[model samples]
Target: MKAAVLYARNDIRVEEKAVPALEPHEILVKVKATGICGSDLPRVLGDAAHHYPIVLGHEFAGVVERIGFGVSKVKVGDRVAGVPLKPCFKCQDCLSGNYAQCKYYSFIGSRVDGSWAEYVAIPEINAIRFDDSIRFEEAAFVEPSAVALHALQHIRFEGGENVAVLGGGNIGLLALQWAKLLGAREVTVFDIDDDRLASASRLGADHTINAKHPDVEEQVKRMTDGKGFPVVLETAGSDVTMRQSFELAASKAKICFIGTPAGDITFSHKQFELMNRKEFTLTGSWMSYSAPFPGREWELTLHFLKQGKLNFKELIFRTFPLDEINEAFDLYRTPGAVKGKLMLLPG
Candidate 1:
């Protein structure tokens, strides 16, 4: 089997390696498609560190080629998507139904070898079965979409509030659709990329504002009649947008921070005062999770994709074979590439 192995920062190569052996609790999946995520950027770029010689890809889906001794939830040849990880049922967090808070878990893409090769092993507890009707390409997205869903659910939303989403990247775009489906009165998206903002508009944002524009804050104020959006989601992972979230949210608004900021973020006294004065309620969301492995976040995302409700297929951007993984990363790192989710076909 051939795998794209990251030897070091900026040194990823496609090389032959023995196929992974299956564990009694695991299943072998013939990799069909996998998607690159925003986090993949820092790891590949050397800004954020990752273990050397890793096969980095977690947002993936495939067909079951072989199942280990104890696997039963999925049989041979079943189409499925593997959750990036599974929690230890014995952990205090897992036992308490807070799977996301599990102190220790094996993350397929980062913690272990992932689906950037011909086949990857996944624990049965982390596998979600998809039907033949869903395209492998679409199924590959279940992971990230589940992350978006988990963020929203973590906020304890019951719907009918207006939402302001900062960042129109894949996660932000997915957040817009999820907000609408959850019955948000209106969904507004903010981003520096007009193209992404356009995609957000197509996806059903009532308004799309380029965060770089000088008038963006004023425009948002006018749109909200100075009251500000009741729900604010910061997904850009930038200090600027993180602070803007405080300025754009209404008094007592629920703010969800889903993006992993590139570095330390500081708030000036005046800027921090906005949150204090407005009583903004902020929650930081990590990787999506729930009890029973991926929980409802993973399940609901699959349901939405299967029903054709959460559509982003047109943004598949580009596809490449395992051999072209290097080029794929180059394109992904390129600015203004009209790229959405870069897919790899390991075949």
Candidate 2:
């Protein structure tokens, strides 16, 4: 098996390794397609996770090459995508189907070896079979798309309210579409990148704003008739944007933080008191998971893609074979050099 192994920060190498063996109730999947996630950037180029010499990939689609003795949900030659989190099924959170909240959760590509190579072994229960109607790349995307959908589950949408997504990246764009699909009256995406802002518009943002604009807050208020957005998503993951998220949210509104903060954030007492004064419902969304393991997020992502209600190919900016992973990383890390997702095809 060939893999892009991350030996340490700024030290990923493409090398050969033995194929992993499948455990009982597991399936050996011949990876057909995979995509690099935004989270992967920090893990590869900066301090993100606690491990060395890890195979770093999880957003993937594959074909089953072999099934363990007890596996029944899928068979050899079946096309599938996998839920990357391996939970301790005995935990209270796991028992309740909120697997992301499980105390002993180990994520593929982070806490465990992942599908950066020709093969990856996944528990049969984590595999979701998809038919030929969806492309391998699209199937690989279900994981991230599921993240977008799962974030919304933290709040209720009774319609007639606007949605504010504070980033125009892939996840932010997906969140924008979902806000519309889930019944937002208007969707506005904010970003500093012109290209990503344009992509957001093409994908159905009712309005796009450059977050760097001096009048960003004023424009947002005007767009929402001075009430601010009732439903807000902070997907930019920066200290600056995290603070602005509070500013953009309306009184008594629901705000979901989908982006992981890169550093410690300092807030003034006045800023902190707003949560109490406005009675804001602030929810922190982690990696997507729910009851039934992969849950409705994965099912709905595939369903929407199959129905042509969604399309992200425009967001798949580039595809590299396993041999060109180094180049892919170089390109992805270049400042303001990209507008879409980068994919790695397992050979």
Q: Model-by-model lDDT, in order?
A: 0.87, 0.87
RMSD of 2: 1.2
Worst 10 residues of 1 by lDDT: 330-339
- Supply candidate 2's per-residue lDDT for 18: 88
Model 1: per-residue Cα lDDT at residue 1 = 92
What lDDT does candidate 2 reach at residue 242? 78
TM-score, candidate 1, is 0.97
Tens-digit per-residue lDDT, 1-347, candidate 2: 88889998888888889888888999999998998988898999897856887998989999999999899889999999978999999988888888988889888878888988899888998889999999999899999898988899867556678889998888999898888888889998989999998899889989999988898878877787887778889987878777777888889999899998878998788877878887888988988888887788999998888999887786899999988988988886688887789998995
User: What stretches of model 2 exceed 4 Å from their correct place?
Assistant: none
What TM-score would every model get versus the actual structure? 0.97, 0.97
Writing each residue's lDDT as its tens digit, candidate 1 over 1-347 gives 98988888878899998898998878999999988778887888774545787988998999999999988788999998988875666788889988777778678988799988999998987789989889999999888888888889999887999999999888899889999999999999998888888889889999998888889768987899999999999988999989989989899999999999989999999999998899989999988788666688889988888888989696687889999988987775667874587889998
Worst 10 residues of 2 by lDDT: 153-162
